[model samples]
Target: MNNELIEKGYRRYVGNKIDVYFNTNICQHSGNCVRGNHAIFNLSRKPWIVPDNATLEEVKRVIDTCPSGALQYQEK
Candidate 1:
């Protein structure tokens, strides 16, 4: 687990090759994540950020679009 991210209030979503982190308090509701990949960022899902649902490149691409810096990732 990413203790640094956790300390910053970012929740971790574990995956095989990469791990996603989300800080809801920092989110700007930009919708980029969901629009970029529904399978990975489905809001209706309980644990919405499923890093394993998409490729590392795809996840990184979408997260890069986050204007608020609320989304981040770390490769394993």
Candidate 2:
């Protein structure tokens, strides 16, 4: 696997924020992250992901569902 991409996928959120960075390459496109939680994951957009759009708890839940480890988060 590419470490650079992995690092890029790992994001940090500030003060109880949700920070999600989905790596397209690593993603299986299972849609679990996008479909499981519409409030946070929206596949229709250009970026297709805005971690800050959802709460930290919600984002963490979705990220955990990612089978490919494509989504990652950190708290600051």
Candidate 3:
């Protein structure tokens, strides 16, 4: 886990190959994330961002669409 991100108010979502980080304060609500991959970014889900729901490449691809810099990731 990244203490720095946590300290910055970014929640961590652990995965086998990568860990996802999300800061809601910085989210632009562009809907790009959910549109890019519903499986990984489902709003109706409890933990909306599930990195393991998709492949590493897919996760990266979807997160890259976050124009607000709200979604981030660190590969394990």
Q: Whole-model Cα lDDT per candidate?
A: 0.94, 0.67, 0.93
Candidate 3 Cα errors over 4 Å, as ranges: none
lDDT-sorted candidate list, best first: 1, 3, 2
**What are the per-residue Cα lDDT tens digits for candidate 3 across 1-76?**
8888899899999999999999999999999999999999999998998899999999999899899888889999
For model 2, the superposed segments whose C-alpha errors exceed 4 Å read: 1-16
Q: Which ten residues in a row have the lowest lDDT in candidate 3?
A: 1-10
* Superposition error at 55 for model 3 (Å): 0.6
Task: Give the distance in Å from residue 14's predicted Cα in candidate 1 to where it truly belongs.
Answer: 0.7
Candidate 3, clashing residue pairs?
none
Runs off by more than 4 Å, candidate 1: none
lDDT of 2 by residue, 1-76 (tens): 3346456764332334544555666778888986778856776775566667777777788789889987776644
